[model samples]
Target: MSKSQGYDERLAVPLRWWAQGTMLVATLWLTVVVAVPGPTAWVVTGVALALLALLLWSYGDARVVVRDGWFQAGRARIEAEYVGEVAALDAEQTRLVAGRDADARAYLLLRPYLHRAVKVEVVDPADPTPYWLVSSRHPEALADALTALPKTR
Candidate 1:
């Protein structure tokens, strides 16, 4: 929730993911130290840890926002005028929509950690994408915000 009148959510990776990544880096440090037994091992471990941090930070930086009559997920955005029906999906429904019943042309902003999602139909005649399936921790809130958008068209 920013100062703007809209919904904003950051899809940050879970703490467990960071813990697991740190453990993996620690294991690599141990293995390297055992094999090389010098400053070279320390340097290698430092590099590995830095790279892991960079990767996790970038991967978890995706954002979903509904503001100023627009819906944005990651790098894609659509005006409210072109937004159609919106639905908040539970874990089971999200699985089905993202897997079994998924459209090839649909825009997807899925995350393995987030089981729930919001499905928003694209009403624009010019767009090839049929809809957007975006993973959200608060799918219901996201759906409500999207549904409340003022469709000027």
Candidate 2:
């Protein structure tokens, strides 16, 4: 069975268009920041640019891969052997986890802009980590795919 999740191209196309449309916005801001050049402004501008880059990468690289019996998200990949359970989580639930762990990270495949999410229990015995909380706009599909996978021993 084929299983995977990704951002809506229709939804993301506009986002990319908007990002590209606003590309020139950076140059203008940089010019203003440079012309009035101050230490604080420079720092702020630098930070803003970094944030833009991160946002772009986060959206551009957003995807979920569940093929050949594998689940891939960002830089991590898992197989059924390493997956325990797949459950849907909304904004409230996600916030709960976010509040607890300072270093917690989730590879969101759906709702880049939404507050809802999904948590998957990875069954990897090699690692102590129990599960991953991923933000997904299409939580039901994600859960279904994950739940259908055969657990690996």
The top-ranked prediction according to TM-score is 1
Among the numbered candidates, top lDDT falls to 1
Question: lDDT of model 1 at residue 63?
Answer: 98
lDDT of 1 by residue, 5-112 (tens): 789999999999999999999999999999999999999999999999999998889999999999999999999999999999999999999999999999999999
What lDDT, from 0 to 1, does candidate 2 have? Answer: 0.63
Which residue pairs overlap in candidate 1's backbone?
none
* Candidate 1, poorest ten consecutive residues by summed lDDT: 1-10
lDDT of each: 0.94, 0.63
Candidate 2 lDDT, tens digit per residue, 1-153? Answer: 235442222123236645763575577567767777767666766777677667665565656655556767655688777887788877777777655652344433444465766788756666666777776666677777877766656
Relative to the unseen true structure, what is the C-alpha lDDT of residue 1 in candidate 1, on a scale of 0 to 100? 49
Clash totals for all models, in order? 0, 4
Task: Report residue 22 deviation for candidate 1 (angstroms).
Answer: 0.3
